[model samples]
Target chain A: MIKARVTVTLKNGVLDPQGKAIENSLGSLGFKGVGSVRQGKVFDVSLDVKDEATAKHDIESMCEKLLANTVIEDYQVEIV
Target chain B: MIKARVTVTLKNGVLDPQGKAIENSLGSLGFKGVGSVRQGKVFDVSLDVKDEATAKHDIESMCEKLLANTVIEDYQVEIV
Candidate 1:
C-alpha cells in the first residue's frame, strides 16, 4: 500500500478570510510580528496500488480533476 | 523572514466525515482502489521574526494554542 499526502493551497493574491480571522485572533492572543496567514487543505489517502510512479500520477490527476480548483488553488502530492 | 507551514491532522481512529465524503465522491468519479481518505488543515504563516529558534518555539506554541486541538489532532510544523 502506498500513502499519498496532498496539500492544496490557495494561490497568491487570493482573499482568505479564514486566514485573516486567524491572524486577527493571533494578534488578540498576543502573537505579534505575524505577517500573512493562508489556510489550506490536506488530504491523506491510502491506495491499494503498489507502484510509486502510478500512485504519484493518479494522485496528481485526482488533485487536478477533483481535489483542487486549479484556477484558484495549487496542489502538491508527496508519496510516503 | 521565515515561513512556517503547519499541517494539522486528526489522530488515528477519529471519524472524519469530510474525508469520507471526498472518498465517496472519488468513487463516484470512477477512481477505484482508494482505501482511506483523511482530511486535515494546512496553515501557511509568514513571520517577521529572524531567529530560527524563536520562530520554531513561537510557531509550535501557536499551533498548540490555536491551530490544532491536541486532544484529537496532531500538527507538524515545517520551516521553509
Candidate 2:
C-alpha cells in the first residue's frame, strides 16, 4: 500500500477569513505576539495500490479534481 | 520573527465523517484503490517575537488552549 499526503492552502491573493478569525481569537486569548495566521487543510490518504508512482500521479489528479480548488487554492501531494 | 506551524488531527478511534466522505468521493470519481482518508487542519502561525524558546512555549500553550481541542484531537507544534 502507498500512503499519500495532501496539503491544500489558499492562494497568495486570496483573503482567508478563517485565518483572520484565528488571529483575532489568539489575540483575545492573550496571545498578542501572534501575528497573521493562514490556516489550511491536510489529508492523510491510504491507497491500496503498491506502486508509488501510480499513487503519486493519481493523488495529484485527485488534488486537482476535488481535493483543492485550483483557481483559489494550491495543493501538494506526497506519496510515501 | 518565529514561524510556528501547527497540525491538528483527530485522535485514534475517533469517527471522521469528512474522511469517510472523501474516501467515498474518490471511489465515486473512479479511484477505486483509495482505501481510507483522514483529514486534518493546518495552521501557519507567524509570531512577532524573535526568541525561539519563548515562541515555542507560547505556541504550545496556545495550541492547548485554543489552536486544538486536546480532548479529541492531537496537535503538533513546530517553531521555525
User: Against the true two-chain complex, what DockQ does each candidate achieve?
Assistant: 0.91, 0.88
For candidate 1, lDDT tens digit of each residue in B3-45?
9999999999999999999999988888878899999999999
Q: Taking the tens digit of each residue's C-alpha lDDT, what string does model 2 give over B1-80? A: 78988889999999999999999999999997888999999998999886988888888898899889998999988875
What TM-scores does chain A show, candidate by candidate in order? 0.95, 0.93
Model 2 complex DockQ against the native? 0.88
> Chain A TM-score of model 2 versus the true structure?
0.93
Q: Report how far residue B37 has shifted in candidate 1, in Å.
A: 0.4
Would you estimate the TM-scores of all the predictions?
Answer: 0.97, 0.95
Model-by-model lDDT, in order? Answer: 0.93, 0.89
How far is each candidate from the true structure, as Cα RMSD in Å?
A: 0.8, 1.2
